[model samples]
Every structure is written in structure tokens, then in C-alpha cells.
Target: MADQLGSARRLTTLDRLAGGSKKGVYRLRLDDQTTVILYVWAADENFWPASPTVPDDPFTDASGADLFAINHAALTAAGVRVPRLLMLDRGGRYLPSDIALVEDVGEVTLEALMARDPVAAAAPLSTLGDSLRRMHTTLGSHFGKLAAISRGEAAQARCAEDVVADRALGHLDAVATRDARLADAHDRVVAHVRHLRGAVSARQVYGLVHGELGPDHVFVTPANEPALIDIEGLTYFDVEWEHAWLRLRFGDAYPALRPVDLDPHRLEFYRYAQVLSLIEGPLRIAETDFPNRQWMLDLAEWNIAKALTPL
Candidate 1:
């Protein structure tokens, strides 16, 4: 990989960027002072336990070359800002696993920006809101993965809310067996999810949702533009699904990321489901040797309390 690029730029430094549990994220600095990010989808870098959750369908932990390629195109076409793709190496002639080189968007994440200074973070957060509007308003004919949708085939005929409800139920069951507190509230949480799920009305349109979008998944460029990363799970789903996550992660800053006219019913259901996801996903990752084990466990425990709030 370096040999090819070395001819022109001369690769000088390679540092593994923090985060990215599913793929290896590395910053490659060339001798010329330019930088690029290399995404390596290999088993060694993946922290998810083998077969963590039973077939999560549309909401699965997404990764790999095919997904990245399709989603990048979909978001780009929708006028959503993603790190510009420099090259894709699917053949694996250089690296053992699928690798992609994209323009380095930089170190500043919206999460970091929000933590460092809220006053300065306002413009970028507002810009992120605009980006969300563009992404969500760019509707799709069907609700499913971008790869599936692009091939002119819908992933399912079921309502988008149904998918969330089902996945949430699965997470609830999985976590109950592991956590005592969740086990205590298992029946009640399940009932509330079902009740809310029943109240949710079916919809025809679906938006391009960044499945696990949070402030951390968003990067702010020097010009203060919001650039989306970890986009493999980009799909056509309920915009409220994305909004629920934004609400959870951004908190007080959520007003800056909120979209207009989100269904209250779907929001209620999806938000609860989001809590379940946080619990289940973190617990699953914690099963492996993820460096943030304590943090992950704390997240699961915190959401366990949040999960029972409605009841």
C-alpha cells in the first residue's frame, strides 16, 4: 500500500486513530505534510464478539468495503458531507483486508467541540442540523440499507417502526440475562415498548439515516462544515430513529441537530429503543477486550435506569 503512494507523496508517519471498534482507523502522514485516513476492515481490529446479537437486520453494526462504497455514494448524492474518498482497495493486493483511503477530515469531532466550548460549537452544531435536514429530506422509495435500496429492491414490506421495536425487544431479552437490574424491569420495559410500538402509525417515506449517528460520529472541518464518518450503516429509515440518537448524544445541543415535524409516537418508541441499543451494544463490545470496558459497562448500567423510566 505504501509502495504505490510512496512514489508520489512518500509516506512518513502512521498513527492509529482512537475509536473505530469495527475497523482500524489510521492517520497516514506523507512527507509532503498532507494526511489521509486509511480504514482497514480486518478481524484483528474488530471488537464485537463473534455473533454478538442475533441478526439485527437493518440496525446491525455495519462495516466493510461494499457498505462504505454504497453509503458514501448515497450520502454524496444526497449532498451530505462525508470524508472525500481518495481510493478503495477491494482487491487486497496490498493489504490483507479491504482498505479505503479518504481525505483526512481532521481531529476535531463535534463531541469534542461541544465539550471544549459550547459558545464556539454553536455554528458547527447548526451546520450539522442543516446537514441532517438535507440527509433526512432526501427521501427513498423504500426503507432499507442503501445497498439494497439502490438495487431497486426494498429490504422489507414491514413498517420502519416495527423494525426498531423488534430489534429493541431482541436487545432487551439479551441484556436481561446479563444484568440484574434490567432483568427486574424486563417485563415492564417490554410492555412499554409494545404499547408504544402499537401506537406508532405506519409511514410510506423513509429518509437516509446514519444508523448510529452521534456527535462522536460527526467531524467538523476547519471551515466548520459537518462531515459524517463511520457511515457504513447509512440507510433509508425513520428520520426519528436518527433524531432519537441525536437527542440522546447531543442533549442540550440537540435543538441544533433536531429535524422538523418528527412523529411524537415514533420518537417515544425509538428513544426507548435507543436506550436498549446502548445497553446491548456496549455490553456486547465489553465482552471483548475493548479498552473502554469500564466505560462500556457504565453505559449499559446507565441506560438500564433510563430504560425503566417510562414505567
Candidate 2:
């Protein structure tokens, strides 16, 4: 990989980073002391795939890598702070799965920054809000996976309501199959989402969104700027969803920075859809050979119960 990037310097150090289910992250230091983050998409057939809640079909390892690369470029052009895409090999030519080499943003994640000092983190969190607003402002004519746009498939564009409806229905099916007790609540949420389809579909705004913007994926630079990472699930959808996730995740920790007026109904529906979508992960892992299978099942049940409760 270093040779491909035109660097003949031998790698002096390599350390694996923690906490990614779908990708292996590593920090590599060349003999010359230059550092870069190497991201290799997970290709194990049994490792599971990209989130089904993402707009359009779930992504395979190769396709997900391509989408991540495309999304990185698009987001960078939209004035959103993200790591520089130094090199990419979406075809898995040099590794077991597709790989990307990106500029190292530093060792600090937004989560750590927040924990270290909530008072000082305020400025960066606010800046993150602004970055997210810029991302939502980057519009697309179609409402689905951003990768589809590069393929000239705008004709298959869907309305935001339709996308959310499909995701909600899928979540309900997955959750109900794993736990029968929450079936009634799942059904009610699905029906409510269906009821709002007409109103949500009529809205005209469509823009790119970081479907998963948890603090782990947000890195705080040495200069105190927020840079986004792990963008495999970027898509075009109602911006309200992004704001809702931020508000739900951060609460009063970060000031609201939505670029447009948020509709209370739309925000609520999307929030439910978001929480429901999260249930799929634990349910899937519960069926695996993971040592913590029972724990995952318990967590899944807890999430299902939480989803059923009023927000």
C-alpha cells in the first residue's frame, strides 16, 4: 500500500485502532515519521454487512468501499471538514477487502473531547453542528444512496417518506422476529410512520446526510475543528433526520444549528425510525457465534423496550 502511494519509505510502526465492526483501522508510521490511517473494509462473509437502514439496498464490502470514497469526495466538496482521501483501492487488489489511506486527523475523538471538558468542548460541538448543517445543505436530486447518483440512476430516486417507511417496516419485521413481546409496539410505530408518509413525501428538501453521526466517528483536530470519519452510509434524505439524531444524542450539550425550520412531526417520526433501526444490529449479532450472545440478546430486548416507550 505504501508503494502504491509512491512512498518507498519502510513502515516503522503499525498499531491497530479499536472499535469498528465493519472495518479494521490502523495507524501506520513510515520510517520518515509520516503517519496515516489505513482503513480496510471487513470482507469476512460472516462479518455481516452494512446497515440495512441505509437508503437503498445494503452494501457488500466492495460496494461499500466505493460508496465511502464517493461520499468522502462529495462531502469534502460541500465544505464539510473530513480527512483528506489520500489513496484508495476499492477493488481489494492489495488486501482481503477494499482499503483507503487517509490523512491522520490526530488521536482525539469528539467523545474524548466532550468528556475531558464539556465547557471547553462547547465551541467544537457547536462547530460540529455547523459542519452537519453544511452536509445537509449538500443536496441531491434523488433521495437514496449517494452512490446511485454517480451511476446516473436518478430516475430511481425516492421520496424521503418512502425511504423512511421502508426502513421502519424492515426494522419492525426484524425486531418482531427476534422478540415477540415488542411486536405490538413495533406494529404501532410502523403504522404511525405509514400514516405520516403522505405529509413527509410532500416536502421538497432533499440533501446528503451522515446517517450515523455518533461522536465516535467525529474527530476533533489539534486546531479544535471537527472532522467526520467513517462515512460509508452517507445518503440523501430529509435533513430533519440529522437534526433529530443530533438532538436525541447530544440533548442540551450542543446548541441546535439546523439550517431550516424543523417540523415537529417529521422529527418525531424520524427519531422513532432511527431508534427502531438500531435494533437490527443486536438482533443479528445474537444469532452469531459471539461469546457475548446472551448479552447481545439482552441489549436487543432492552432497545426494543426503549423503542416502544415514548420519547
Candidate 3:
């Protein structure tokens, strides 16, 4: 690590950063009183337990330095701000998997700032709104992960809406086996999704989405710049999908991330699908050796209630 940063700025200490489920994130303190972040794509650090039962999709355990680099480039091109890339190690020279060195944009997430002082956090939050606009307006001819699409590796799979519906139903079935609440609400949930899905009109063009944008994923720099992180799942899809996430995470402040033309049917349906995903995903993680089992179950329970809500 010191060799990568050159001899002048030798690494003095390393501290693991939180919220990285698919990769190892560490902060490197150098002798020069500066810091940088290192992202390791090692398999051992990943928390998502692989399943042979589930059908594959774009959002499945989205990770890797290739995805990061591609998404970073595309997002930057679209005027969305991300951490500055210092270096990327893809060769087996470092660890078995890929790694990256990026600028330390600070530890204060927009979520934290908003929690600390809602009034003062207004400026940075507004900047994030612009970032979302740029990302939403950047259209892609086809839908898929930014890396796969860039490398011409994207499959001719079903449209984004269908993918959401299929995954929602699959999760519905799986969650039923694990939780009695899902088993009882199974038919109603299916009916709600199918009804909303039917109301959604099809479209050809797709826009870039952060896929899982939350205030927690946004870091506000000292200069008041809001930079996006943990962006490996970045994809080109229906903008409504991203809006659904923003509405959930931002809650009342969702209007800041703007677009007046979102389809109501798609937004409602996707929000429910996202809730189903949250329920199933956390339970799957809790089954693993990952710590914080209680919190994961709590999240699953919260989302389960949301999924069972009347439409």
C-alpha cells in the first residue's frame, strides 16, 4: 500500500470503514498527515451468501473494481460527483481480487449531517439534488450495469420493469418460507404488484440510477460538495426506480431530487418491490456469519410490514 502511494507518504495506520458489504473499505493514514481510502474486492470480505436458488439479475451482489471504474467514469461524464480515483490495482500483484485507492472525501455522510442539523444541511442536500438530475437525464440505449454495458457484455434480458416484477415474486415466494407474515400476505402482495405492473406503460430508453442512493451513501466534503460512494450497483434503468429509492431514503425531502414526469404506477410498484427486496436481503445476510443479526432482522421486519401495507 505504501509503495502504491510512493515512499514520501508512507502508510502509518489503517482503519476499516463501515457499510461495505461486498468489499473491504479501509482508510490509510499516511506520514504526511493526509488520508486516502482503499477498496479491496476480496471474496472473504463479501457478506452476501451466494444462493443457487435465486435467478440472476443486475442488482445481485453488485461489486468489483471494474464496475466501480466504469460507473465512476459514466457518472462523472453525466456530471454526478464521486470520490477522486487515485489508483486502481487489477493485477494479482496486490491481493487475489481487485483494489482501488480513492480520495478521502471525509466521514460525514449527508445522512449524518441531516441528523445533526437539518437547517444547516440544506446546501449540501441541494447539491445532491443536482447530481440526481444529471444522472436521471443521462439516457442509455439499453439497460444493465454500467460496466457490462460499456464492455458490450450486457445480456439481451427482459426489460427493467419485468425484471423487477420477476424478482419481487421470487422474493415473495422465498420470504414466505422464512416468515409467516409473508405467507399470509402472499396473495395480496402479488395482486398489488400485478395490478400496478399492469398500469405501467413500457418504454425503450433508460436513464442512469445510483440503484441504492441514500443520504448515507452520500458524503459531504469540507467544501460542501456532496460526493457519491458505494456506487458499484450503478445501472441504466427506469428513472422511477431511482426515484422510489430517493423517496424512501429522503422521505419528506424527496422533492429536492426532481423530475416531474415520473410514472405514478411504476413508482408505487417499484417502492413495494424495493421493500420486498429489503425484507429478503437482510434475512439472507443474517443467516451468514455477519455480525449484527438483530439489526438485520429488525430491518427485515420493518420492510415486511411495509410490504403488507394496503395499497
Candidate 4:
């Protein structure tokens, strides 16, 4: 964190930067009248196992800033609402697998705004839907396939494979093998994800989608314009992955907006994928919110029963 005057100045101290699982974001005021943003290197150093003892291939926040900028540019070029790019740090060399940089954008994120008023949340949902439709209809073909080994697939085959493996052997025992329920109830989530995948994609139907569609990545500005951020997981395979995710997080509440059309079987698979993502991420975020583990168990049972149903 260094700050130099004139141009290409590095900000040592970010006024107010908040973040979650992956990156660090900051708000800065430039010499100009309008305010801009600065995003820097910030990744979980201890995220993966055995990395610390080894040569170190930790996920860097350095390269991602540029990638995110590029993604924003691409989406913006396609008539989407994204922060107007002022500058990108191309001069800085990477420290093997490290990333660090800043991007200047206008206004606050939809998530931030929604923090003030829950009812106002619906506005961003509609904008997200419209933006998604544009991306899918126009650039869907360019997105990566959501595979476990694929370049940018986030929580892909892991959850589905876990659940299927569990159910194949038995019920409870199988689930435990897939997920360890320690401080948090991970087993029930694993079972739920597997169950949904089995029910939906049981007959073999899968397709393209946004890959990871959640509120956190979607941004709504002061002007009420909706824009999508964080597209590292822009993927193709498993339409159900997107549908189920949107459903659990936002779909159930917003019935007026229908998820993209896919075959019944594929849709079901997506549902499971989403449930797994929520369990792994948001559910983890709200683990203590639930009174007991029974609540999670109930959700697993419900999803499993649904998955077992014929599509």
C-alpha cells in the first residue's frame, strides 16, 4: 500500500473497504470531482491444504483485478451498466502467482443499498434479470463449461458427486462420507445438493447458464441501474446450476421472474447445484442463524424426496 502523486499512484490506505470470501474492495476520492474505487490484492492465503508447506500456489488477488476489469469492460461494451474504467495497472509484474491492482468505478453496489431497505431489494433483482438475459442471449456461447476441472468452474461437480455417492451406498452413512458435520451442519447440505441433482438431471438434461448467479455478485447503483460484478465463474454447462441458485436465493421470493427455460430434468439438476452452492457459501455464512441441526435435516429430506420424484 503506497501512494504517489500525479498519475499511477498506489493507494496505501483505502478509506472504507469491505469484502467476503475472495477479494478486497476500496473506495477512494481522486483529485477529480467524482469519486472512484480501488480494488487490490486480497485472497485467502490459507484457503487450500498442503499449499503452505509446498512451493506455494496460493490464489493471488493481483491478476484477478485486471481480469475483473476486463470482464467489466466486456460486459459494458455489450450495453451493460458497469463502472466506467479509468485506468488499470499493467506495469506491475506478478510475484509468480500473485495479483494486485485498482479499478475506478462509480457509485455503490446493489447489495450495499439493499442493506438499508430489504423491500428495495426487488429493484436490483429485476435489473439482474434483464442483464442476465442480455448476457445469455448474446454471449452465452462464449462462457466456459461448468466442469470440475474447467478453468473457472466454482463448486461444480463436487456437491453433485458427493450426494450421488452418498445415496448410492446408503442414506445417513453415505452423506457423512461426503460431508463432515462439525461446528456447522455440512452433511445435510451435501445430501440436499446430491438429492436435487439426482432428481433434476436424473434423466440426463444439462445446458448453459450464468454458472454462479447470486446477489453478492450483482451490483445496483444509486441511479437504480443494475450491473453484474465478479464473473470469474462465467460458465456454460448446467443451466440448472444457475436456476437452482437464483431460486434458493432470490427466485422463491420473486416468482414473477422465471428462470431461463431448460428441460425439466436439467432444471432439477440446476436446483441441486444451487442448493449446494448456498449450503457451501451463504448457508455457511448463516450457520448460527438456525436454532438446531434439525432445520437443515428437514431441508435435506425435502430436497431428497423431490429429487427422487420422476421428472
Candidate 5:
């Protein structure tokens, strides 16, 4: 595999960049003068974004990479600004099948920009809402039954169980007393969930959506085209799941959540789903990737507060 990664004719010059949990990414130049990004799969640990939620397959690392390829193809064909696929290798000796060679956008990721200026949040949040609306409108139905679209719900529930079992959830519970606002927020969220479930059926609200939506995945080019990447969390479930994830990351400052287009209930559902994703995902990632345990605990506490919320 090392030799394959280093080979210059087929794939050459892999300079490691950035990625989540288990995958290794690099900027490579193919012999065809095609500069592409390569993903090399190697997962020694599972768990991240930090909680004690074990993924469905604690050691299963290869599946999400392949799934991303499929999602990319679909999104690209639908006219979404997804990263173009240069090549795909699911897992093989000459070409490990799970990896992919994708076009590098060479632009600033929203995450980086947000880090530089978090106070000036409105512009990027609006841009994110517009991009999400485009995606949800264009390709949500093609992926699966509307209700099954958001995989985050299933993932989140499982993570909650795992956290309880592993005693990670206990960590957050311990801090609740000290953080009264966090506790109050948690209660409000729960009430919201109860109201939503009672008000509507899952079929009316579900569809395939980007299971994960955040500053990191939403990339913006100088031309203002917002390209969505990191398709690992794509799922077929409640369309609201997507909205919820976006709301959690970007908050209510989003421009499009007006009376006509946005549904707060759906956003609540998707947000809960995202909370589960973060819990299970980070708990399974390598420790080196998340050195600040306290920060992770803080995030987990926040998500947990969201997840257990009623609406």
C-alpha cells in the first residue's frame, strides 16, 4: 500500500493535508498532469468529536470512503458543486478500493474562514443556508425514503447508549449542575422534541439529506460557489435531519429560516441527529486527533443537551 501511494506514474507526490478520525489525505499529482487529492485508508482507532459512543463497527473504517464516492457521483450529476472524482479505488493491492482521487478545490474551507472571524458569522451562515437549500431541493428524494434520510437519528441513539454504557455520558451529567444555562438549554430541547413528534409523522418529514452539515464541510470558492464535501455522513431519513445539523453548527442567525421555506421542527430533528453523529464519531477517533479532552467534553455536553431535548 505504501508503495502504491508513492508510485509516481499512476499516483505520485502525496503530501498529507487534513482529515477526520481514520483517513489520511494528501495532495498528489498524477502523470496525466492532473493534480488531485488522494485518500489513504488506515484506522487504528475509532471515536471522536468525544463521548463514549462506539460506532456500529468500531473497527470498520473502509465503508464510509466508498459511500462518499457514490454520494459524490449523485450530487455531482444533480449539478451540485461536489468535488469531481479523478479516480476511485474501493480496496485493492494496486489500488485500494476504499480510497478515491478527487479534484482539489484549492479554495478556503468555511471552517478556516470561520476560525479567523467567528464574530462576523452572518455572511457565511447565509451562504451555508443557500447551499443547503439547493442540495435538499435537488437530490433529497433520490437517495431514499424521506423518513429514512437522516442516518443521524439512528447513529445518535446508538451513541447515547454507548455513552451510557461506557460512562462517558456521566461526564456531561457531572458538569450540568455547574452550567445552569446548559442544563436549561437541554430541558428546552427535550420539550421541543416532544412537541415535534406529537405534531407530525416521520413520513411527512423524512428524506435523504446530508447527514452532516457544518462550516468544515461547506467550502466556498472565490466565485461564491459553496461546494459540499466530506460525504461520510450522508443518509436516507428525515429531511429535517439535514436542517437540524445545519442549525446546530450555524445557529439561528441563518438567513433562510424565514416563514416560507424553513421548518423549525425539521431543523430540530436534524440537529438531534447531528448530536448523535458527533458523539459516536469522535468517541471512535484516535486520541491524537483530539488532544483537548476538555474541549471535546464541552462539545459532547452541548450535543448531549441537544440530543436529549424533546422536540
Candidate 6:
């Protein structure tokens, strides 16, 4: 790792940063008093196989380091604040998968900041909204996960309704096997989604969306601006999807700075879709060797119940 930095300075400290599921992040300090963030992608097939059940892949044909570098450059160019890239190893000549060294923006995350003071956090949350609006301003011709290697088009764009319906079906299958009530709610949600297909087809606008923009992925810079990190799940979708996530996470207080008029019904549909997507994780974990399998199943049921509730 020190050799990759091209600095002969001795390593002083290495502290592992939390909240990563596939990759490992760490705070690295050199004897020369330089600090940087080290991101290591998992190379093992168990963690990142070529053909996984999930459709999304951060390292699209490119290596993880290259993908991160490209996403950082693209987001930064789009007027969104992101951590500055320093060094990257795309070929994995030195590491297992790929690695990158980036400037340490700050120790505080938006989640932590919001927890500390909700009122004071409003500014950063608003800044986040602006940043997201800027990101979504770059429109896409199609809808789905944007190819990491290319900016011009999506690698696998499909009908928006098709995507939602597929996910809804998966949620239904998973829940139906366990809970009958949740299954019935999922059926209603699926039918509602099917009915919205025509409405989705009529829409023309689509843009880049940070598919997973939870508080942890957003950080505060020393300048107090909200900077985005973890670009793995970056994709292209309706800006309303992003708005739905924001509304779900932060409530109706933070309004999206959108150019087009958004449909409330479409937003509600996407909200339920998002809930269904969230339930998939717990369901998958429940099937695994994890100790809290039953707990995860219960959590999935709870999310289904929430999804069924009126918005």
C-alpha cells in the first residue's frame, strides 16, 4: 500500500472505516503527516462474482479502482462535490481486486450530523438536495443503471415499469413463501405498478441517480458542503425515484430542486418499490447462515407492512 502511494514515508496509522458491505475502507496516515482514505475492493468470488444474483455491478467491465475514478470524475464534472481522487490501481497489480487512495473529506457523515442537530442539519440536507438536483440535471436517453464505463448511455436500459414489476415480483415471491398478509399487500402493489405502466411509458425525462443515497454515503467537507461518496450503485433513473428516496429518508421537509413537475402518484409508486427493494436484503440474509435469520425475516415483514400502509 505504501509503495502504491509512491512515498517512502513510513505508515503511521491505519484505522478501518465502517459502513461498507463489499469493499473495505480505511483512514491511512503516513509518517510524513499526510492522511488519505484507502478503499480496497473485494476480489473473492464470494463477495464479487462475475455472475451474481443481483443485477447491479459497480465494477462494470472496468476494475473497481477505475470505476471509482471514473465515477468521481463524472460526478465532480457534473457539479456535485465528491472526494478528490489521488492514486488508483486499476489492474490490481498490487492488490487483490483494485484499490484507490482519496483525499479524506472529513470524519463526520451526514447521518451523524443529522442525529446531532436536526435543525442545524437542515442546511447540509438542503445542500445535499441541491447537489442531487445538479446530478440529476444530466439527463439520460434511457432508464436503468448507468454503465460505469460509459457516460453517453446505459448498458442495459429497459422500460421503467418492467424494472419495477420485476422487483415487485421478486418481493412477492420472497414474502409469499412466509407471510400471507404481506404477500397479499405485495400483490396489490404489483397490480398497482402494472396499472402505472402506461403512465411510466409516457414519461420522457430520465437522469443519473445515486440509487443508494443514504446518509452514510453523504459526508460533510471541511468547507461544510455535502459531498457524495460510495459511487458503486450510481445509476440512471427517473429523478422522481431520487425524490422518493429523499422524501422517504428525510420526510417532506426537504423539497427536491427539480425543474419538471413531479407526479405524486408516481412518487408513491416508487416509494413502495423502494420498500420492496429494501425487504429483499433481509430476505436474502434470512436464507443465509447468519445468526439473526429469524430477526431478518421479521424485519422484512415489518418493511412489507410499512410498504402496504397508505402514503
- TM-scores for every candidate against the unseen true structure: 0.94, 0.85, 0.95, 0.58, 0.63, 0.82
What order do candidates take by lDDT, descending? 3, 1, 2, 6, 5, 4
Stretches > 4 Å off in candidate 1: 1-8, 52-56
Model 3 lDDT per residue over 283-309, tens place: 899999887789999999999888877
State how far residue 212 of model 2 sits from its true place (Å): 0.9
Model 3 regions lying over 4 Å from their true place: 52-56, 155-157
The lDDT for every candidate, in the order shown, is 0.85, 0.72, 0.86, 0.47, 0.52, 0.68
lDDT of 6 by residue, 219-289 (tens): 88878888888886676677777777777665544553333457776776777777776676677756655
Note the residue pairs that clash in candidate 6. none
Query: Which tens-of-lDDT digit does each residue in 10-51 have in candidate 4?
Result: 434447454433444557665444355655444442121121
Which 10-residue window in model 6 sums to the lowest lDDT?
Answer: 45-54
Q: Mind giving the per-residue lDDT tens digits that candidate 5 earns over 1-311?
A: 23434554575466766544446667876676656677665443223333333344221232355567667765676556777776677657444336777777765777776677665544655655555555566533223422223443333333222222233233334334445654566455445444544444333222446665677777766665567876655544445555655566665444343312555655554344346445544433324445455666566566655555543
Model 2: per-residue Cα lDDT at residue 282: 71
Name the Cα RMSD for model 3: 1.6
Give lDDT tens digits, candidate 1, residues 25-60: 999998888899999999999988854443426767
Show model 5 residue runs off by greater than 4 Å. Answer: 1-13, 29-34, 45-63, 91-97, 114-130, 139-196, 202-205, 256-260, 269-294, 304-311
Query: TM-score of the candidate numbered 4?
Result: 0.58
Instruction: Give the Cα-based TM-score of candidate 1 against the true structure.
Output: 0.94
Could you tell me how far off, in angstroms, the CA of residue 127 lies in candidate 2 after the best superposition? 1.8
Q: How many backbone collisions does model 1 have?
A: 0
Clash count for each candidate, listed in order shown: 0, 0, 0, 8, 43, 0
